[model samples]
Target: MFEKQQVIYLAGGCFWGVEAFISRLKGVNSTEVGYANGNDLAPTYEKVCSGKTGHAETVKATYNPKIIALDEILESFFKIIDPHTRNRQGPDIGTQYRTGIYWQEASQRDTVIKFLRKKQKESSERIVVEAHEISNFYPAEEYHQKYLEKNPQGYCHVDLNLIDDEEFDHLTKEEYEITQLSLTETPFSGKYDDFFEDGVYVDVVNGEVLFSSDDKFDSRCGWPAFSKPISEDAITKHRDFSHGTTRIEVRSAKANSHLGHLFHDGPGGSPRYCINSATLRFIPKQEFDKLQKDKY
Candidate 1:
């Protein structure tokens, strides 16, 4: 009962973790680890790892548009890898570990470019991700397929369970309830309600940057309020009819955690984001700058 399926090839480091992570997404139909865009007619893992086959360790993700938008998938990919880095991801270093997005459908090219443009604008460093039409791909060895599933303790840079409900195990009880259950914290009781620091607030589950202090303002709404998010696309807004009233619910785009609600009234009539403090973790400016440099 699924809709037409579309595929994208992603090379975001080791294929094992990439496959494990992407395969668990809501709209994904299937995922396979493989060698992609290589010159060798029959490339093997050993050859590709040598960095001579011109192949990137990639995952082929088949997804249904009716279930998950292509833009969502692109966002998820960005969350897992540092697009500003070249020929590496995590601890892996080599051309084979380079990050890229390969599309087969001609219509998807523009969408990918637009996504990259938005991402580029958000960062000061140049994005090194390769986005283009799929040239060629060969399925990886049988042993490499579903490697994490077979070996639960397998080495993986990514948290394979990030998209699952149980993945919020790292969050505190109140944080988990608010983020995973859409339960709002008491407005005036939030940790950040009166705490304004020169830094950015990030998704508690995945550390994806959500809001900056520059956009935050004291709305006196008994909650941590922000004029706007770091980016319009950073959060997704949905119509909420809970409590017998209609409101716009906001959630983290990558983590899909219930962050807060968006209200129309604010300073200068701008939108006000009433976010839960438990659902976020603040990274100070000094530490955030070091993290950025470490990624390079």
Candidate 2:
């Protein structure tokens, strides 16, 4: 039997763009434009625009979790909306334009919080996006539903072209520099430099398992230090000649993304793999097991 469908309410500026972009995702079953989390029981687009309805233009997205996780959806949502800005996105400036994640399930709260925390660390500005249980949701007028599909030239705040740009599209600015441009992050500045959570680190560009916590050790080198990767085939080593020094650089085998470097100086003669946190995504042991179980 197929897994039950999952739903997530997303309010990212105008609902038209949110619906347009979210509906096109691979696992998305459907999307509906709506006014959500409003005090007024009877909500109309006109009332929402007037800033009295307390409703944000939201998109109700239903997707198959087996194909796409909630974190992926949240990550995609961030790409289209400005989380740092309050009550505004692109040209729209109103209370209804505020971005939010209104979830239905309590289980999703932890995931949302974790994702937001990671996003907060990556951003220089305070994130203003709200995460809460949805109070009320009302379907928008029939005319407003799938507005972009009906009117191709409709004004949309989101850049729909980003969906097609797979390479370096999902990566952040620092991640792109570290992975694609082969730039090393500053010492002691990465998120995972001091973090020793029980999890597996995967390539940021692609979800390819690279290292595990079992192989991780405190090298005090101001980077995430690992004794070895999960598998020898998971990574490729290259001779780096940058900065007038010879160093063995580590890169993900699948995406060929620049990870960090390999050093022979480690405890007990084991090679130390100093990796950039920006170039990796850590999945906790429980979550990893759940993901593996969900696959089959």
Show model 2 residue runs off by greater than 4 Å. 1-3, 165-296
Off by over 4 Å in 1: 164-296
Clashes of each: 0, 0
What is the lDDT, from 0 to 100, of the residue 154 in candidate 1?
94
Give Cα distance to truth, residue 237, candidate 1, Å. Answer: 30
- Model 2 lDDT per residue over 173-281, tens place: 8897677556678999999999989989999988999999989998999999999999998986765544547888777766767799899899978799999989999
Score every model by TM-score: 0.56, 0.56
On the 0 to 100 scale, the lDDT of residue 114 in model 1 is 99
- Computed on alpha carbons, the lDDT of every model, listed in order, comes to 0.85, 0.85
Candidate 1 residue pairs in clash (backbone atoms < 3 Å): none
